[model samples]
Target: MMLEDLYRLLRSGHVQAQGVVDTITQPIIVLDQNLCVVTANNAFIKTFKADRDDIQGRVFFELGNGQWDIESLRQLIGGIIPRAAAVIGYEVKHDFPVIGQRTFLVDARRLVHPDDNSANILVLFEDVTERQRHDAEMDFIVSETRHRMKNLFAVVRSIAMQTETKGRTAADYRDTFLGRLDVTLRAQEISVSNTPADFEALLRQSVNPLGAERFHCTGPSVQLSNSRIMPVSMIFHELATNAAKYGALSGQDGEVHVTWSLEDGPRGRVFLRCEWREENGPAVTMPEHKGYGTELIQATCAHVGGMVELKFHPEGLNAVIKFPV
Candidate 1:
């Protein structure tokens, strides 16, 4: 039924008026011109955990130890309603006892008795706390996605600039740059996925394409935190790329052994130590000068508070990587 119909029933002193008001699902209260509670529906009493005897004659602002004495509510009812005669969806946030924090959309209307020229205000409260929380979470996700995209673009630019073109054909340069770019993007993807990236999974992603037979990997289960995943993944990628080009994976019957363990560090801190050993490839010799791949590997390791030690042995190459967990 409409507000007008309820007003008429209340004015006519119909016994069923209270029943009709109670039938409404939304919490509602009727107040006199002086802002004293005239009547409250079942929803209002149940919602606020109040009694009929305590509510009927009390001032709206003084109800329940003045929990309802909100300044915004006072201004809306005392100041705004007089001029507007009606207000719809006026928002109010309050921390209520028993219910904790809550947000409400308040709708109010001033109903006047035609014959007697007396007035009563009808107020309705709609709860929207959960909806607001969901909206806030969505906003955070959007902002985080934008930030990741910008970082990804910056990383790609760095890779393109640092990749060497000297003494290489166009196709060779293209392949090298694209390979690094692919590794960076893959790291980004794993970092953002619902499941967190782990040490073994990242290693497999970096080197499995070269053929699983080329590498034997064994390590204790270690979970990578979000900030550490990208750098650690990139480190593995660069190492694998180098192995494929000049170390174990480049020659038939060659193999790489990958293993890692967690160790206790100074001040009770924990660290991860990983070993990558290549064997049966071409005899190892130190490069005359540092290359971009070596620099990239070092940079990525340092990005995550880590370090790498590369050794050129007669059999092959061995790298020892250490980083904080």
Candidate 2:
């Protein structure tokens, strides 16, 4: 009678828990209320680097730490039951012995038995390190694109305004617009499609027309990826044009100095700041009327979460920009 009862229990389908675990796409792991491993699917076995016989009863946190180290995984899994909330897409990285690289998105669900509310918890693991990285890379590209186009708009507006107020005739304004656009394009190309922008490269190009002898550059390894290049390029254009027209480039002996630095602010965040100062130039003054270029600079700088300041002294002009890197 006892053997028949046991046989009937095993054949009733209730004893075969593995069937449910085997169907999931994500790695599924189930543990009793004490957090001891009860069952793990093949996906789970492969993800955690365990054989069916070895991992059936082991703790969840034995995986080495760093990128996908199991200690973090344990904490994440252990909390799901207590917190009674589903955790989704938590990113982790690990260097596993069996696998050269491990990056995973972990998900967990607090499982309760229908007959016994406190029996066990279910955890799901999804490998999505590649997807997360791709998303971040795409985000950087999009941000860079938006920033660069905004600067182009500003540059065009500035050219239009400058021509409208001072041009001798329609053709003169048209030609000047075209010339300014050409200069802007050089920077725009670097902003939009260009993967990276060098501070020195922009300065060199801006001052190239006047001659390399007229422009000087100073900075460390400052490279802004596409996301930040757009505004930086616009600021470059403004300062370079101003120096050429009114500051050092305006005179034969004029000199312009450009430098950059990175600083750590409150709460350990890094930022970029650039300074432009002129030597041997006329006094600077705020324009009585704001021009299109001025508006463009101000608006675009603010749009990209940056601040711009322009100063005119008896000696020449100085512009400073500070922004998130």
Top lDDT model? 1
Candidate 1 per-residue lDDT, tens place, 74-148, comes to 887886445745778988788887677989898877865667455788889898899999999999999998998
TM-score of each: 0.77, 0.46
Candidate 2: lDDT of 69? 37
> Per-residue lDDT for 1-325 in model 2, tens only?
6999988988777546666667666788877766667788878776667677766665555423332435666677677677776667777676567766767777777776566566577777888767877999999999998997897688688767755445257775575467567766776667657577776776677567664785677888777767766566666665666566556677877778778898865556567777877887555566666654566667667877778887766676677877777
Report the CA-based lDDT of candidate 1 relative to the real structure.
0.84
Candidate 1 clashes between residue pairs 3 or more apart in a chain or in different chains: none
Model 2 residue 28 CA deviation (Å) reads 46
Instruction: Name the 10 consecutive residues with the lowest summed lDDT in model 1.
Output: 78-87
